[model samples]
Target: MSQHSSVAGASRPVKEAGFFTKIKNVACLKSSSSSDKGKGGKGKSKSLSNKVSHGFHLVEGQSGHKMEDYHVAEYRKRKNHTLGLFAIFDGHLGDRVPTYLKDNLFNNILEEPNFWKDPEAAIRSAYSSTDKFILDNSMQLGPGGSTAVTAIVIDGKDLWVANIGDSRAVVCERGSANQITVDHEPHAERRRIEKQGGFVTTLPGDVPRVNGQLAVARAFGDQSLKAHLSSEPDVRHVPIDSTIDFVILASDGLWKVSC
Candidate 1:
């Protein structure tokens, strides 16, 4: 029951995190608008250094439930540098987990010990620890889980992305688009899931699902299926230059149709 907010048309320093220490007391940042079920919005922002203008749009899906996807599109000042933070969190079963992520995931990543020296390691560790936190508090977070794709642009010089589940990041350069994150579908990692004592099923008319429940093989929360699920994200880093024009970060709803 949290309302969504956006940092569109302007930039702000990453705010002090609104941490969640108590379950029922959690609240998301207040916003004039909300992306409730069947409702969507669009926004655009520009970086201070490179002037990399980034834009995003969310479209309500056909699903007849409250919006489960959460997102962040903002520019932040950190350590005398401007960082562009973009992400999509696709939730299933409930919204608590994604809402938790929309609030804390980036804060957790930037706070990682070696973020400057090794972003990949820092991101990996953060993802693992974040997922652990979600799983450990599943009773309060609910039985739901979410797939996430986060992109961080540092001082307009580098772009680092990490993802779990089917949410993806696509980088555009010289008029061509290239996907930079892997889609963690159930069939691709069946062996690992099987070894963990879980089974994926593909009915005649349905897509493969983990334990006949979730569609993604890796995600945060889903405490009931944690034994077979992986929260380890595929992390990628790239140096940005003149050729790197833009990047798109979106939840699976934007791409699942083609598959």
Candidate 2:
């Protein structure tokens, strides 16, 4: 996997207004205050279940550029033990890499022998293995690449996050947002890339990118840059407390538009 330019060329003009308008419409429709009074004055209410103590919600926004290749998944093994995993694979040139990651990464992690005992090690193994799997199967996948950021929430008490790209995970607690996963941007994550002899630059007609090709510094599928881009994820064991609220996991599209 090698990074390629996603910057729209001269043919694709940026549609700022249309992009934001669609986002606004989707946001409004999902809002609790939105009224559904067409067929009747009553709106469908979310069922409350006392047995269901914890739940998960996921929403994927469209890509402002080509297709939204990002993928997300949330699963629970048992009623009390919940596992929430979300990934943003910013694909460049094609969607094969992201789609491949979405289908295989979590399963690889869960299948690891050490997963039940040591989640951090399991995550590391899973990341490396998945990357290798992609490279081995690259002939079947075309010449595209992707950045990966994944988070796993276990039992609503522990969070293990891994990343190799600019996709972000933010924890909104006590009315404030705290970034959980570090954005693997060349500019911000310069130290790591520099240690590996990698650099960042902007092409003559392209957006700022890592190594003049990738916009992100770390990633799993960039086989060409494996010597520089990392696959080891930053793992943290966080205990969910009273002050914690819902977290937001989004791709570069949302972060680029918002930040």
Candidate 3:
């Protein structure tokens, strides 16, 4: 079945969450529920056991520029296992890259030959291949790019997370938050960019940027800055247990604003 979501020209809000000491609840795109799109581009779903669910809300940004963000939240059956897929693709310059990712990234990753035996290696391979495809077809996809954070839950038993740029995933376990992805900001990876013959610039009042153009040092597409950018993602694996509550996959406003 198709995903329950993908934001169009709108960087929608995720689940409505209010944090007061006693953590109430949060939402995710339901893994087993049918599409539940409502007014204003919203959708909700629940897992087969009804133990976990997801929801989304869309809202346009006030930056004047059309929103380029896109997302994925759905479930798929593969090899007798139920896989819950979630992701956030924060784009800049245009929406082409993120839109393409929302539609194709997971497919490519799942199609990797070694995905079942060596998930990490398969994920890396797919990430590299996907980025190559995007860069190779820059003319058709445009010169824009996107930062991404993706999570795959295997029957609520294992969780796999991977990311590039600054899109992030935060997991709540026993009511404590833990970040499992790393941000590839220009400032953090300066030496690497310089080694690629690109320089990072930090003006007095601005954040560090790759060659003074893109704010992130790694992402998909960005053919114009491909030489200085990396598309490799930092992937992690976490075994799920009773203590784990939920995971939030998104690029917070801090990352969103810079892009």
Name model 3 segments beyond 4 Å from true.
1-40, 254-259
Report lDDT per candidate.
Answer: 0.74, 0.57, 0.72
Mind sharing the TM-score for model 2? Answer: 0.71
Q: Which segments of model 2 are wrong by more than 4 Å?
A: 1-65, 78-80, 189-197, 202-207
Give the per-residue lDDT digits (tens) of candidate 1, residues 7-116: 11222222222211111011122232322322666644456764666555555655566677777777789889888887888888888999999899999999998988
Residue pairs with clashing backbones, model 1: none
Per-residue C-alpha lDDT of model 2 across residues 108-161, encoded as one tens digit per residue = 988888886898899989888887887788787655677776777676566677
Residue 36 of model 3, lDDT score: 26
Clashes of 1: 0
lDDT of 2 at 131: 79
Candidate 3 residue lDDT tens string, 124-151: 9999999999988989899899888888
